[model samples]
Every structure is written in C-alpha cells, then in structure tokens.
Target: MSLDLPDLRTDLETLAEAHGITGAVVAFAAGDEVAEAATGVLNSRTGHPATTGSLFQIGSVAKAWTATLVMQLVDEGRLDLDQSAQSVLPGLALPDPVTIRQLLAHTGGFEGDVFVDTGRGDDAIEKLVALLGEVPRLSPPGAVWSYNNAGYVVLGRVVEVLRGVPYNQALRTHLIGPLGLTRTATSADEAILYSTAVGHAGGEPVPTWSLMRSNDPAGSSLAMTARDLLTFARAHLSDGAGVLPARLARMMREPQVTLPDLGRPSRWGLGWELQEWAGGTVVGHDGSTPGQAAVLKLVPEAGVAAVLLTNGGDPDPLVAELVAPVLSRIAGVVPPAPPTPPDPPLPFVVERYAGRYVSDVMAWEVAGDDEGRLWVTVTPLGAMAAHGGSQTFELVRLRQDTFVFAQARGGVHSAVAFLGEGERARYLHTGRLNVRRSL
Candidate 1:
C-alpha cells in the first residue's frame, strides 16, 4: 500500500493550525513500512519546531503500557490478575475485594480521579496510596465501569512491590528498555533530557510541565513521540515476544466491560478500549493532561497502527477527522461515523431534572435559565475543585433523559444522562455518576 507522506503532512499541518494547536506529531505503521509527520512549534515560548522525534505527554494512553508491564508480571507468575491489591501492597488501604484485574479494567468501584501531588520523592506512589485511606469507595468491586486514575496508581504500587523497585525503574527495566523505546521516559526529569513539547492551556503555555510524581503509572508521568507510541501499538498488534506473550497481548484486547456513556468502541478490555468499528476492531487509548492531548490507535486485522500527540488546543476533533482518512486510505479501515441524536429527539420534564447532584470529588447543580433552557453548573470538589474550579454550560436536550454539553474550550460535546424518571431520578451520569442530593 503506497502512502503519500507529503500530502498527509500538509493535511496534518492545516488541521493543527485550524485547531490552535502549538505542536503536533503523527506516526503510522504498516508492517515494515513506517511514516511520520510533525507540524507547528514545540512551544510558542521556545520557537522550536516539532519534529518526528519530539516527545509529548501521552497522558492516560500510557495506561496500556502500565497494563502491559502488569501482564508481563502475570506471564512470569509473579502476580495474579485476581489477586487483591491489598495483598500485594500490604500497607496499601484499598478494599480487599478490589482485585488487580479490576484495577486494570477500571472496575475497582473506588473513587478513581484523585490527583493529589505526593511530591517528587521516589516513594510518591506509596505516599499517594497512603492518601487513599480516606477516599470513600464509590461502588462495589467489579460492579461498574468508571475511568479510574487512582486504580492505575494502585496498580503502579503493585508493580513496585512485586518488582522490588520504584515504579519508574520497574517500567524502565521491564518494558521501556527491553522494548527499545528510547524516546519514552517515565518522568519529566528524564524527559527533559530529550527534545520535548511544552504543554499549553488555552493559547498560553502551561506553567507546569509535568504531573504529580504519583501519576507515573496512570499516564500523567510518561512522555513519548508519536513514532514510539505507534511502535508500541504495533508490538501489541503482533505477538509481543520479548515484552508479552501473543496470547496475553490478545487478552488485553478482549472486552471486559461495556462503557455505555462512551459511544465509540463502547466497551473496554484490560487496558485498551475496544471500538468495534465497521472496518475492524481498533483497540487503543487516549490521554489528556492539563494542556496536552494524545491518541494512539491500532487496527489489528490490518496490522496497522497510528498515533497523534499534541501540546495544546482541542485535538480530539482533529484526531477524529485525521485518523479515519489515514486508516481508510492506508489500511483499508473505514472509521465509524459520528453519533447523531435520535430522530424527533426525546423530551424530558425539566422541572424534575433540575436539582443538585453530589459525588465524592465533584458536584453538579442543574437548573434552568429564565429563557426556559436547562444549564448545569459543575463544581469540582476537594483538591481537584481547588485547582480546576467550576464550569457552567448550557445543555442541549437530545433525549428524554439525555443532554449534550458543548464545552467552552474545544467545543467538545459530552453527554449527560438522568437515570430514572422525573423526581424519582436517582443519579445524573456524566464522566462519572453523581447521585442526586436531597433538596
């Protein structure tokens, strides 16, 4: 399959500028053939042009790497997916029922989005788990799917304890070094040694370049180039001989849970999100940090993979638009179409839906404007609330119980569903489910 690399580069550059992105890198792999392109500047402040080798924070996409490491331990008989996290890290305070597999699958049913800075010390993950002692369990283990950040941190602790080393060292010795991913680093300190992209928020460069040390395993700590990311994806597409057995790699892509709120792929595997598109099964993960967004995707049947790493602006839409054409033209994989609202749209009683919903980390106050339109004011609670503050957006009704919010930043649309009917509705579901609080 011949690819017009120059044409693809031009298209990517145009898309990046249209999105206000500071830096962008894209890489594609088809068996032995590989192609890559970069556009914009690494940092507006530095005026450095992004190259194919420029590293960008891959965010939660690194979760698949961490999962791969955990699977390697499983391959060695050093860890059991069903083993309780508390048993592995005896000092850790997670619920005993929360198994290693649940953590990997984001089904541990615990408060998962905790992002407290545990400091720059080597014991950061340990300290971060120590802080988990006070976090309330959101649901029973293996009950439901929630994008759990804290669960991955616990998994990181599992790696450290089982490997008898820090999370960073364990990742390096077991995965990064052996896989020959020279551009990938576990923390900002090591990443600084390479040509890197500085993250940006809005149109301004981000003040901080890295996440808290504790987020290393959860993806806040790793940085890599688009080429390296696709390389990793390609390894997963084949028998991961040195890194993981082909069977285990295949296991990681098996559907573990259904993600109803997330329309695409709508199901998750061990670490990969399973998107059963019309073309084929494209397994991958996306990552987002303060001012960076990254996406890594692979079409296994086609033996093809692609990755996009960006420093700033809303790269989600750009990824949606860019990856489809690349995959279709290069790998003969047709991308899924964007979801549309139901015909005639479902109607709901606005009066009953308007109320205060509360959760461990955030709160949502749903009310109506004088113009009879509904709006939700989201307030982040706890430490996250202190940092991210609050955001209010008007909700466009899509169904009797569902509405979509076009977020201010990237004009990204997110669905909000009210479970139950009228005043009997018990919860409001958005990134995570928030139970309705009493009046």
Candidate 2:
C-alpha cells in the first residue's frame, strides 16, 4: 500500500487546523522520501512558529527509550528479564514475585499512585517506593495489567543500578548521544527552563508548573522534540541498525503479552504497544500527563513511522488518524478492523454497591437500576459512561462478590474490591483501593 505523500500533507494541514493545533511534526518513509515536516506555532505566547526541529514534551514516549536502555542491559548480561525488581534495587522491599518483565509489561499489580508530583530522580523514586509500601495490590504479580507508573519508576532505578551512573547520564550517553538526538533529555530540572506550552485544566489555563520526574521503571517523565522523536521512531522501524543491534531492536518490538482482548488496535509488546493497523501492527504507545499527550507509531514491514506531540492534554487526533491511510498507501493492504465482542449479562446484585463514595479529590454516586445495571454519576448532568448488561454492566464474582469492572475489553481499570460480606470497600482506579466502605 504505497501512499500519496502529497495527499497526506494536505489532509494533515486541514486536520490540524480544524483541531486548533498550534504545531505539528510528521515523519514518513515513502518511496524515495524518508521525510519530516512541522507546521503551526511552537509557542503561542511568543508567537514563534513550530519547525521540523521544534521540541515538544514527548511525555511517556520516553518509555520506549527507557525500555531500549533496559534492552541494552539485557544484551550486556547486566539485567535479567525475570528477576525481581526488589532484587535489582535491594532494600527497597517491593512485593516479592514481581519480575522485571512484569514491570515493563505493567502486570506487576503495583497500584498506580501520585508520586510523580514529588519532583525528579531520587526524590521521585523514594516517594514511589513509599507509595508502593502503602498501596494495595490489584492482583498477584503477573496476573493483571494495570498500566503501573510505579513499574517504570523502578525501571529508572534499574537503569541507575546497572550503569553505576545516574539514570539520566546513562540515557544521554547510550541513547541521546549515540543517536545524535541533541534536543532530547530526561531531566525534570529542564521542565522549568523552556517556554513550553502552558497546560489548561477545566477550561482554565494551568500555570507553567512542572511535573516531578518519576524514577518508576514504568514511564512517567521524559521530554523531547518532534524531530528527535521521529528519529527514534525511524530507528525502531528500521530495527535499530545504526544505533542498536538488529537483535536487540527486534526484542523491543516483539509481543511480550497478547492483548487482543483489550479491544481493537490493542496489544502490548515488551514496552511497546502493538495495535492492528490495516492488517499490520503499528507498534507504539500513547502518553498523558496533566497538560500533555503524545503518540508514536511505527510500521515495521513498511519501514515508516510517525511521532506526534501535543503541548496540551487534548492532542490533535490527526497523529493517530493518519496511520491507516498512510500505511495503506505504503503497505498496499488495508489492515483488518478490530473485532467486536459479545455483550455480557447484567449482574443480579447491583444494589449493594450503590450510593455515593467520596475521596479527597472527587466524589462519585453509584445508583442502582431495575434493569440490572449500575451507573456512576460523577457530575449532575453527565455520567462516567454506562456500565451494565446484555450490553454493558459491572460484574461481581459470584463466589466472592468482589467488584470487577468488566467489558468486552476485559478489565482495563483495576477492580473495586468488596470484602467481608460487602460491608466495606475501596475504589481502586488502576488497582485495589485501601479505603474501606464507610456507608
């Protein structure tokens, strides 16, 4: 499926404009062109136009870079994929049985936490380790996928241990320096240096506040420009020929977990996400922080890849929307559409989990329905999507009556556990919550 590059450029401009995008950078491999482009403004406040080299916070896309670093350690025999993270960073005392692979794949059942707000490097790592001591597990290690940031925080520490240098230094020496990606760096310190796009929240602009750099092995903090990201994408798509060995590169993209049930276009590789695009897999991941979002995709077979970064939380969808059309032109075959799953039955006992649950941050009201569905109201006029049966609904394990949010996609969020005859409970968004039912 060879693509018409000219058509793609036209569509991208139109789409970005429609979405109020300030800037965009695109990279492609079409016929003779291993090309890149940037459009719109880099800093709306300064009135500077974005260029092909303009930097944007690549957000968690940095995880792939970190993952590649781990792969290097693997190749050098300094790290074992199956060893416990606790072993790598001893005296930290993380739960036993959580392998390094679980951290990379986010299956360690480490409940997500707010440690990223604590600033960067050692401080952030210490905060995460403390949170790990308090957060309840969602499931036994390796049993579930919860998108744990704690996992990546630990990975950052792993990088430090294996290299005997600060994680940032190793990243610079091995990744950024070797790749000639001058604009990229993994410093929380720099979060205050640039004239970055200010983030907005609740329709109001958030100040130019910075994020605490995370030491979790799972990706939390890293920054880069559009061109540097494109360079990274191309390297992966090309199997790291120049920057990393072909064997290690292949390992990075290989599927470590089968996530076919995570819905259409969803799969998980070592640290890379695998999604079906026009019958081929577009391997990449999406990132989000308070004020940023980014996506990086690569088509291995076609030798084409794309990197899209947005300064604001609401990113222009054109980054992902362009993949299929571009890949079809390049690959000559439309990837198969994602499949749909049969709806499950509504649970019989939805009343037990009804009523309002308040937390420090927000409040929620869970109301029961006669139709056997449970709806959660986070606002007066709007709800958090419908959850219940024959179509969609929450499920309770009949044997234990534990609450698990299930859909055709299985349980993407951590289950809200019910314990001791359902008298008390806690709301775990990505893992089990510690708060018992107060009502």
Model 1: lDDT equals 0.81
lDDT of 1 at 99: 89
TM-scores of the models, in the order given: 0.93, 0.76
Tens digits of per-residue lDDT, candidate 1, 240-307, equal 76689999999998888887453344688998888877768888899987788898888888888888
> Which window of 10 residues has the lowest lDDT sum in candidate 2?
381-390
Per-residue lDDT tens digits of candidate 2, residues 275-391? 766557778877755455677777787777766766542353564367555666665536554332224543445555665554322345666667666555442211112212212
Question: What lDDT score goes with residue 28 in model 2?
Answer: 70
Query: Candidate 1 clashing pairs?
Result: 265-275
Model 1, poorest ten-residue lDDT window? 405-414
List ranges where model 2 is wrong by over 4 Å.
1-4, 7-9, 30-32, 120-123, 188-205, 215-221, 260-262, 332-366, 370-373, 378-439
